[model samples]
Target chain A: MSVTLDQARKIIRQTMAKGEDMKLKPLSVVVLDAGGHVVAFERSDDASPGRFGIAHGKAYGAVMLGMAGTAQMKRAEDQAYFMAAVNGVFGGHVVPVPGGVLLRNAAGKVVGAVGVTGDSSDNDATAAMAGIEAAALVGEI
Target chain B: MSVTLDQARKIIRQTMAKGEDMKLKPLSVVVLDAGGHVVAFERSDDASPGRFGIAHGKAYGAVMLGMAGTAQMKRAEDQAYFMAAVNGVFGGHVVPVPGGVLLRNAAGKVVGAVGVTGDSSDNDATAAMAGIEAAALVGEI
Candidate 1:
């Protein structure tokens, strides 16, 4: 399942549009390819300056590890050494939270991921999912 | 001023090389384009996955706010509410610390920034600066 940059950009645009339509505060959105490279990104004008990277990092983490960011945080709860090692290794890219979602093709192959920030993790996840669905990509709850 | 993807990748590679030469532990490096969007990034295989996000966040915060992450940390002390607001707005992307450096062009225009983690904040800053220098870009110390 190859994810195109155009699709990623479309997801981001639609997501941002929904956020605006809902009057959600400024948000940051990111899309990653299957290989974990960034495909597209944006930080809303109202979004805090660094929100873009946070969103991207979380999304990148989810895709690379093949798990939710929140799951990683859960794992960190009982494993300081693991957490520290993660901190040491990834240079801080893996953010364990619930704001990211994996994208799958119709064949159920993981194609990419989307991450959103500037809201609760749940809300961020919701927005990302909405975007993915709008793009006709399969996303898991 | 624009920071090219090639320059960003170069920064990460050189920074990682310096870390290896100095016998530092595995490192994660991130480069942010103007407006604080990630332009390019690479995570060492041995580096912890979390380092990727943390490094990017810290660096994004530094450049987005036009100050060193450490300086922001210092200011946050007196402006807890503002800092909290930043955190909320950024959705966990901002890390006020010393591990990131702002990148500038010849005209003193901030074109991008670099962030490194997996060691002391000072060490991270050193690596980030080295990468910036290697790119022939001026770094705001």
Candidate 2:
């Protein structure tokens, strides 16, 4: 099954909590179901408006790749034209960064994804893992 | 203000219930806040992949119109060039159809819009109304 709204909210909440605990910058988080339709999204009060789109694009790209998002960076570097075309197909919602992670269910099946934005890409990825693990789901970080 | 994630999910849940009750086809639904930012979206397991974009477009069109979307159909017919240009401005995320309905609060303020896709436009409109009503909000259908 794809990510449910409740699960998506939990991921957002836990991501926010992790960001606070880590003293990261104000963050925006997005969770997309397996099919890449947004299930839920939230941005910390101080986050810039652009954070939302960035977070969403990261998750959308990761979900479409069916893999961790950091790998996208290497692809973008090695195959610039391919990455550019893929971004066009997704309306530019693909971010080649470390902030995107996959959400998997008990059977090790990717059911959705969590993307975070605000601080460094590494910090964002850490926050994403924190949230996914806290929600009792597997994180393919 | 704008629609909350909780309210958006409630609308989707109720919309799915209504569709199931009426035995309509598997559906995809979208909820966009007043600013036309997507807040929440969902689709049945078997829904076609294109449903997500269709639902999103319908909701985006209605939210931008800030009025009942059926009026959009008339405008599109009367001023085809303008409608086409407007759609281009929105990156082509506009569906001039009955399934798009604006959401209002108790004060009759436009807060958001909900769009549905799967069945016929009339049935989709019916489902949209059911969702808006169940959420205890007003539907500007």
Q: Report every candidate's CA lDDT.
A: 0.76, 0.83
True contacts kept of each: 0.07, 0.20
Docking class of 1: incorrect
- Count of backbone clashes for each model? 21, 0
TM-score of chain B of each: 0.92, 0.95
Where does model 2 exceed 4 Å of error? Answer: A1-52, A73-91, A104-112, A118-127, A130-137
Best by lDDT: 2
Worst 10 residues of 2 chain A by lDDT: A43-52
* Local accuracy of candidate 1 as per-residue lDDT tens digits, A1-141: 546655776688787777777667777787777778665566664456578668877887788788776676677787867866875777788777777788899999988888888887777777777788789898753
What would the per-residue lDDT of candidate 2 be over residues B37-70, giving only the tens digit for each residue?
7666666766775676788788889888675678
lDDT of 1: 0.76
Residue A93 displacement in candidate 1 (angstroms): 15
State the lDDT at A69 in candidate 1: 66
Model 2, C-alpha of B113: deviation from truth (Å): 1.0
TM-score, A chain, model 2: 0.95
Q: Relative to the unseen true structure, what is the Cα RMSD of model 1?
A: 11.4
